[model samples]
Target: MRREAMRHRLTEEFFARHSTVVAPDLIGKLLVVGECSGRITEVEAYSGADDAASHAYRGRSSRNDVMFGPAGHIYVYFTYGMHFCANVVTDTVGVANAVLLRAIEPIDGIEQMVNRRGRSDNLTNGPGKLCQALGLDRSDNGASLLSGEIGIYDDSWPDRSAGRAIVVSPRIGITRAVDFPWRWQLAAERNERNERRRPGGSRTP
Candidate 1:
């Protein structure tokens, strides 16, 4: 019998949905940047025209044109004049909605990520930190997730059996839309108690 490797990749249709739908679902997905891989632990959603916090809220520009491209592409940009942050393009061809990959749990290439970040703590715990640890820069902007050096795979899916629960909170590291509870993360242990109290389990938003 021919051996077949288990594989699962999120399709463009998956990303073509609203950012809110894509954000929480991204948790537990695998982000593969070159040889480094991690399980997505956190993400924040940004609506293009509706969200004041979105880069394309006022319309696209030279720097944010990639955000308006087709879904399933990467949108990397420089920030703080010293660090790079990355986001995943979402919605339709003209829509600029996206989900910012806030943090991840390292699963592969730990040594390389540590070397890049020069420390282990918070290596991929923030937008900029995750980009740096994964060696993602502006050059990776507009890269297609379907065929590129960087890709997201659904190799592992978080569920009750995985002992994890999704938590939603307002986005961090931003002033605009700070009150919007659009951030999502995996609660490793707290969900057990929540699951017992909440009927029909938790739901993503």
Candidate 2:
């Protein structure tokens, strides 16, 4: 299959269309790094000021500065002084909205992800875990998912059809955004496939 070029990658409008729509659509998509790839599993939506669950609900700050920037940019932040979470900037340039990338099934660089996570199943199972597996840190905060080393690809995985994909309730983690039902969890097929491909198979959240 031909790889999608940078120009064909997702644009700002692509992200602003409606996070609930975009979240499930992102399932089964390929997040590529060099030869490695990961199938997106879980995602959550945070609207701008309208949604109290969103960080932009209050206003921009040193930590949420990226959400105010262009859409499709990575907005990664460290929380609890120990975990790192990641979000994809969305909405207009000034509108502070984002989609949190909650989990992924390692499709490539499993060994590297394992090393970074220090545990096989733990790798890429949560927001922070997936970021660490992908080598995402504060430096990549404003990085665009459209181009450069860390880019998204349309792998056109055969099983991504709507009927095959399963959508589940959001994971119970956040306190402030507890009531919102916008979070989405993708099925485990991708992770199972990855384990079959790599020995010493494992599972993740």
List model 2 lDDT by residue over 1-205, tens digit each: 5344322455556776566677766766677756556877778888767777777788888878898887778888988788788887776778887788887777678998888878877677778788888888888888888778776655654435335555656435666757777877665554455221324556575
**True-structure RMSD for candidate 2:** 5.2
**Candidate 2 has which clashing residue pairs, if any?**
none
lDDT of 1 by residue, 1-205 (tens): 2211434777898889989999988888888888898888889999989999998999989999998999999999898899898899999989899999888888789899999999966678778888999999988999999876788887733322265678898888788988999989887454233111334666544
Estimate the TM-score of every prediction: 0.86, 0.81
Name the weakest run of 10 consecutive residues (lDDT summed) in model 2.
190-199
lDDT of 2 at 148: 81
Candidate 1 segments whose C-alpha is farther than 4 A from its true place? 1-4, 157-161, 189-205
